[model samples]
Target: MTRALSAFLVLFGLIAPALAAPQNKDGDSAEAIDLLTQASKAVRRETYRGIIVYLRQGDVDTLKVVHRYYDHEEQERLISMSGQVREVIRKGDKVTSILPDHELVLVSEHPPKSMLGGMSHFSPKRLKANYQVVDLGTARTAGRDCRVIAIRPRDKFRYGYKMLIDSKTQLPLKLNLLHHGKRLEQMMFTDIAFPDHIPDSEFVPSYDVHGFRIVRHQAVHVSESASDKREEQWHATNLPPGFKLAEDGVRQLTSDASVRQMLFTDGVATVSAFIAPAGLRAPLKGATRMGAVHAYGDIVDDTQITVVGEVPAITARRIAQNLVQEKNTAKKAPAAND
Candidate 1:
């Protein structure tokens, strides 16, 4: 029932006309898609340092970001300059997060395919299936001229995006996540500097970690023997349209317990389902929404199933309730290709 979704439903009827011929619609679509395509690339390939103002649910924080690409690879470092001396470094599939305040370090390796999801190049054709690309004219952000663009979602299951892309560098100076035509989250660059060289030491953690506790998230490797059909537990039968299972695996959270995880995405929104022993997680207790995160839980048979995503609470609840114990294994979709 969001305004964006309502607008999208009406927009669908005009899609054919929009793409028809020499018209402003066609030009707008192409321009919006082109800008996003280039911005995604610039975010990963270009080396830059900036101060980003992040706001969500009325709270704001100023964070510093540094990204560099070399030898056909990309690396990033995030530093929280206000509250605590915390930093996160990403090098390919492995990410290291350090908390100087708590003397802890978290290391986790994501599915190599989804590791660079944010930086992946976008496909206009594929994107058009779920969103309406519109040009919102031009504006100024971070002291630079920007091409304002809005990506309105076609369904309530996903959120819309508004971006102010730098005209010169093709980078997003301000990005906002919207719902009901309201900004739910915003990330805007207040100051930026593109430097010639950002040393490797800037990415390294400088805090004293002599006695820090380390929590390593063991990687889940789906081996040939483990892929046998009978070993899988549950499958989702009522998944929302356009959503595909991107990855699924089993990981041992403790010496006595192991959990099954399934990841799904509909090009924009990502959802995760975690199944563990019945008592490990609280029973299905409706939906819990905090800011942009929506979570729901349920007890399926003897397993506790929790579904969480950035989408609406209804989406998370529907996904959680669709868990079935049938033996049919879920076929995962291939990684998105740009």
Candidate 2:
């Protein structure tokens, strides 16, 4: 799991905590649930277009997004307006990302709904069990009256979330990612409008004068034995509250033989951990900040593991230290105490 959340924040351009306000009182409010439920529904049923800016440490990116929601069909197109020329188009379970100079396109098959799309996750009750949702009063965004809902992390491993949802339609107007009292990063619809129609041609791919090349590649493979087997049996004893294993596997980079990865999420935030053997060719030990996302690496137990996510340095450090590779046995297994 290469800092799962950090890479995702860069790739998807959604998710983050920005600008902090004081914590809200804890409660199970019919009003809060009703407000959040409405916002989730609105994101699914409405068609909108807007610009989203992703800010991390020193990097800032603006992406123009066009979205359409009808029936069971949801389509989105994202074009990078700064930095490198990158584009991503998604339809339901399929996503294709195109890189200009690299002349490569990567495709992923996903569940119909993902956290980035503002879709529901697991059961609302499961999330409420670990997070305390509270009403943080109101704010004005893009001329819309918005109600703020704060999700306070009940434990240390995970950060907190505050959202400004449209009061009229219950749609998310802005989202803030918070760690310990400070706003790490944020994403909001600086300007948004519910459009009546979006032409199908808008979703088509764009090509330049030199044309392009396609590289069809399969998913990265990890050997079940030998040197690569270490990652397959790795486990963690300490994790932030509300976070659970979401996805895991190996993804081959263009330059590597294979890279093993593990993904965890708390419905909204995702963190990826990547493991490779330590050697002259392994990744370095250091931390890099991009807007609200943090990428950090260290050599642990002779294995080079890099933990990156939209989380605080302390959270990432604790997660890195808690990784334990237990020995296997044929008998009943005993659970490790935290």
TM-score of each: 0.83, 0.74
Instruction: Please give, for residues 225-268, the per-residue lDDT of candidate 2 as tens digits.
Output: 43356534766655665666655566555454556676666655
Worst 10 residues of 1 by lDDT: 1-10
> Candidate 1 lDDT, tens digit per residue, 44-95?
6678898877777887777788878877877878788765677888886677
Among residues 3 or more apart in sequence or in different chains, the pairs in candidate 1 whose N, CA or C atoms overlap within 3 Å are 284-297
lDDT of 1 at 215: 91
Each prediction's whole-model lDDT (CA) = 0.68, 0.63
Candidate 1 lDDT (Cα, 0 to 1):
0.68
Highest lDDT: give the candidate number: 1
